[model samples]
Target: MNVPELFEEGWYWTSTQYSPNLAWSQSFDDGLQGNLVKDYEGRVRVVRRFPLN
Candidate 1:
């Protein structure tokens, strides 16, 4: 299940914010969800949303 070609095994930040200084993050290595400080750097994927018209 470790597909390096698809995504690297590391923590990825999300748009969810726990506080002004904390945000949500997910671990690609173990599929765990948690929060982290906004000042810390992590991995992320480009996500785009489109409205249906």
Candidate 2:
């Protein structure tokens, strides 16, 4: 098993959208998660896992 290396932590977006003007995000720094406005500045990290066939 291998662990991914993480650099400077930042907030990441979530699919859990709040209303039409807000969205949910997670902070990798302290695991601080909250709902923030869409305009709030944040970093986006996307990943996918493939199953062995």
lDDT of each: 0.85, 0.79
Q: Which lDDT tens digits does candidate 2 get at residues 3-45?
A: 3356258888887898899999888878789999999888777
Backbone collision tally, model 1: 0
lDDT of 1: 0.85
Kindly report which residue stretches of model 2 are placed more than 4 angstroms away from their true locations once superposed.
1-4, 49-53
Q: Highest lDDT among the candidates is held by which one? A: 1
Q: Against the hidden reference, what TM-scores do the models get?
A: 0.72, 0.69
- Candidate 1 ranges beyond 4 A from true positions: 1-5, 48-53
lDDT of 2 at 17: 95
lDDT at residue 6 of model 1 (Cα atoms) = 78
